[model samples]
Target: MQIPVVLLFLGLLTVPGRSQNAATEQNSATDGANAGEVEEEDPFYKSPVNKLAAAVSNFGYDLYRQQSSRTATANVLLSPFSLATALSGLSLGAGERTEDVISRALFYDLLNKAEVHNTYKDLLTSVTGPEKSMKSASRIILEKRLRVKPGFHSQLEKSYKMRLRALSGNTQLDLQEINNWVRQQTKGRIMRFMKDMPTDVSILLAGAAYFKGTWKTKFDTKKTALQDFHLDEDRTVKVSMMSDPKAILRYGFDSELNCKIAQLPLTEGISAMFFLPTKVTQNMTLIEESLTSEFVHDVDKELKTVHAVLSLPKLKLNYEEALDSTIKETRLQSLFTSPDFTKISAKPIKLSHVQHKAILELSEDGERSTPNPGVNAARLTFPIEYHVDRPFLLVLRDDTTGTLLFIGKILDPRSV
Candidate 1:
């Protein structure tokens, strides 16, 4: 059941920071009245978003493992949602074999075919729609000359709400144009992302996300100072450490995973969870292995909010990676070497590269919220000491839909 498909070069990028949605800032000004309208959601346990979330999470972990093996010493970050969204759009033009391959790779086979695409359509609209808390978007780029099937074009535009671009033949101009579009979309947080256009390119699919999440409870900037960040037990570098004595946080220790997990809420529907290894030299292999949709859901269910003196490094990072090996690990092997994308274009095409780049800038923002009188205050006894001074895994998620926006291991924030 081989499907005919084109060669794909998938590139992903992200910029996360302390500021609000830059892409939507202008829109909010023009559409101020509707900006405050609330978004509706189904119950978390019953929603199909959870199913897709699990699939993306598994794919993300698999991809992270591949990248980790290659760059063990460097920081790792990947946006599974971004990659999956792009791939799903590409799948619209795929023939039977190609479609099957993408379906298996993306865990789409587990869901009813009719439900999968439409659910993704809904998810994309909600995440990238008006009144978004973070700035994020994904799209597919094809050579201008290629004749895209009308059905594929209509579905891509209507369902995915993706903007398709035609390469202008001028490599430098096209490169500049691509970078400019990304810059405009991400509100200039990331610029000049593509250095040079690939000469052999037939089709390229990419996704980018930019988020500057403000903590619900702000950290004191005055208390932030340089402190030792352990790269390993033998190595330590000074980094700006942000501390709050009465930081209210959800805390849990996973005995089976052998890691301490803490969750901090962000404004809107987003939340960030950190997994710190008990030993300074310990890496994220175990935690990476344990990441699954149900496991993360269970972790949150088990975690209880507590009073803690939290000390965390002020993180600003930029990371890039290639995803060929990771995609190869999935069921879509033939796609890398030989496959037909006749539906996309009459010309023969094969994938050459799959790459990702991300930038995250996190800091204390806004006035601190006072703790409530009940559970938050009661848990203040002998406050837990959760200092993230070493290598750890951090996940940013949409608490409403249970979607994972970004996941990565911070080996050395000092490097970026």
Candidate 2:
């Protein structure tokens, strides 16, 4: 089966509070004082879009950590770019004080804040371009009767390409509309987005995305069979595992993380990075905490290309969560109670809840043609063994723009 992925995100913001300045003024002043000194730019952050992508990707890592910590035993999957996009677009509608809260949460404090939205337009185009096979859409929803400021509306549309929605007060109709919009954005890949309408919504941010990937090397269908997947030291489950005796992949062993890292190429300039712990029932907290865009990039560069006797599970997973509590646990707690969105509307508003859902599938589907010429030319030696039989972490990244499309921790394939 083809590997299809879907992600949907919604953030609900409602009623009044005064805006308070974030505590970054002292630091900002210090940085400003030192700005006169000329310094070489870091290659990673040299471009505006790259800088913005790194900041948001870092936020994605933090979001994944928080969600993973909450559900320690269960699988955790998130397409945080969608959530980050929604929040970034909503920041345009925020007053200075409230905007700082969002800015800090998204790590925009580290970026040239003035060009963020504009750079995001470029980043969006690059990641969701036709060649990428990814479709993404975001929107802002308002209360039934709330009037949006013309300036905020225009800026949001111009930069974020998002439409504003005013609730009609009919719960079912509003719910239907939101779901339909999600379906339309994902080309019918995602059906129902929300089960019910949230009450007292003053403003809402919504985003959806869909992606399908084909592996560079296809696994033989005949080799796929039910195999034992170790869940823990004492537990195991049978899952359909795809095997390839001679798989060419980039490999690395992280002594610090005590995990094997493998990089597999996918079509459309995307790559899947997997981190398999050294043993079953090992604590993954260390590896989870170590995840960052820079670190992953370093690992990506340091990995070695080699032949591997590989075995991977055929996985189809779905996840849905209301991330209000998770967001509260982060640095963004104040948004739930006290936030100023006067720019969006004169009336006061604060964030209420965040909802997220994602679906991912991976199977033995790819080009039936011969492997890459490099793989064919390599002399056979002692091929390393890389089996994903235990719990593992996965990251799907867009190579061209360095955008994180998805992150997942698979504990039990059967559970999904």
Candidate 3:
């Protein structure tokens, strides 16, 4: 969901994820609780998020790939294809975040299988943690329901209860326990994430997952001291930053979106493809067009070493959103096909709600080093910025399917 959702059941239903019924109104007392706040920004806003979105968009495209030029009905199905588009467009953000895509995907794939779907009703609550990192990897969390078996009408929902069960109750195991789980997961590289949880409206059939984690290796404190970072047009600013010159995944520019792409390879070839704008928060058109899976592969092949520096501000942000509108904008409303879907309807499934939330924090680790306090008169072969002065994006993906696990853009880091 591009925003959050509140369910006003005709009568309150004590389902999972809620103790008392969530009211159907806004939290006025919490100012900007839904409005976003700015945070430390990267000169470019497309890195982590846009990369994730591109991967997801490509995956969505694969799902809708013409099942066959042979099917005469394929052309008419274009409308519902918007569902995939809508799913991809959301990477710009929904708030209270996680790079959670795998757990949700595994869960979704299970739901698509009747044996699993029928047996796992509370699967959302059944999932937990991912606290322990899988070798060479990252994650994305999402929870939303989807209609299936057209004539049969089926739906499913899954989230982090499994992670909760997996938790030893040690605060360290909690998803939100670490103040900068996100910063660490992304290598002190990503600084701002929206501070809103994915919406909580229940659905008969939905898919969802959340991800928050710390990087296995953090940047050296001495290297993290203030430095001037690059912005578009050769513009630069002095800000705090971090570095991992040894990181397997290095940063560089990609022709796609004329933005830079970061690759974090997971075990067995999987990787997170982070696409970020060079100088500004991207609009729908630029993002919707350029990105492709082959292009990602090409970029991976062409990766070259470069000085990577960033100065992102510490931020606290909050937001509430309803992605229904964003979905429509992305050309996805047709999946609701109460009508066309009726053609495939052996089962009756209707999507009652969809929502999301995300939260993120970025700051300097206690470690420090003596260096140029402000301007760096010394020129080095490579330069990385410390302060985040502009908007940015990130993503998680699977190398095998080239599936985009998660994607989002950080327009206002303070709000994340």
Candidate 4:
């Protein structure tokens, strides 16, 4: 079989939260402080998950920036956390220059050697562990003929909680099995994830994340309507737009970056943030430049809860890309060329292909838009109107763990 490896990162954020009346009291107009609101401290920030999250998101941002440079007029999205987890599993079989390259590329070289894999073990377990909010899984697949080394096998089973699949020579059967696994992992949000099986495949690394959450403040569908989305300064297209007239969310502005930022809550301690340009033609460079882990943490701390009128295009997106150039750009060139995998097999082997696929679907489904029972609405404030009618960057994060679940740029929501 050809060495056609696939890294499928599926992030399914399903909004199914129980309807709750949002706080009707007007928020104080303070910049970073409210009279009695105290920010909750998250323990995961100093944990290995945070470090891993940082490294992975940084890699994803780097890849996004590079891809945007070449395809400046197209949409881009990927789950860096998924890519990192998949690669870390791949690293278990690598040694010598190959291991070093993967380590450096993921910035794992900066972490403690003894703790890295184990930390990943903890991270994976926590993420995929039983939670009402999200579901996640990762796997490494190999052909049945490839003999697994004893030491590698033990570590793989123990630390990674990996479910190994031995592919049979039958192409159709293999495709069905892979698709079944994908469907099971993603809770059926994704079906027929793999179009076809590659005839020449040696190993495949896959990671998936599924999240189902309810908006703390649901968008008023009664107010949602077809709105003009500026694809470019001169071009426009119509798309379903979600709106919340009395929306209350964490808000901030970065004058130096020339962008408006807002954080909307989702059930189970997750949040979706938007980075919108101040001008129609302003590139996302500054916002992209501000994607470091430290920067995000700072934003969370500095932003204040405020009332606002928010509007955004409802997004339904599916993205896939071959990473031949991304891997090289990220300086993991050794893997594509000469590197050691003695731990995995006795025969000389090297990576032949790397690919990623992602999917995102968002809407105000299965939730009530009207207020619960008989809650009375407080007098409205002169809310700042934040409309996302143009290209913007979005980051979905788990507030409890500071984990970035999804990140992407929507150049055109009308384009599937």
Give me the candidate number with maximum lDDT.
Answer: 2
Per-model tally of clashing residue pairs: 9, 0, 114, 5
Off by over 4 Å in 4: 1-44, 209-213, 365-382
Write one digit per residue (lDDT tens) for candidate 3, span 138-194. 122222232223222212112111111112233333335222444544344334323
Task: Note the Cα lDDT for every prediction shown.
Answer: 0.70, 0.78, 0.33, 0.67
TM-score of each: 0.85, 0.88, 0.42, 0.81
Residue 342 accuracy (lDDT) in model 1: 66
Candidate 3 deviation (Cα RMSD):
19.8
Task: Give the residue spans of candidate 3 off by over 4 A.
Answer: 1-207, 221-249, 264-272, 280-288, 305-320, 329-331, 335-337, 340-349, 358-388, 399-401
lDDT of 4 by residue, 97-119 (tens): 78888876776765676788887
Task: Write out the backbone clash pairs for model 4.
Answer: 1-200, 1-201, 2-200, 2-201, 17-214
TM value for model 4: 0.81
Q: Worst ten-residue run, lDDT, model 3?
A: 17-26
lDDT of 3: 0.33
Count clashing residue pairs in model 2. 0
**Clash pairs of candidate 1?**
2-97, 3-97, 3-98, 4-340, 5-340, 5-341, 7-350, 7-351, 17-212
- Tens-digit lDDT track for model 2 on 238-314? 99999998888877676556788888888878899999988996899888887777566656655667777899998
Q: Which 10-residue window of candidate 2 scores lowest in summed lDDT?
A: 11-20
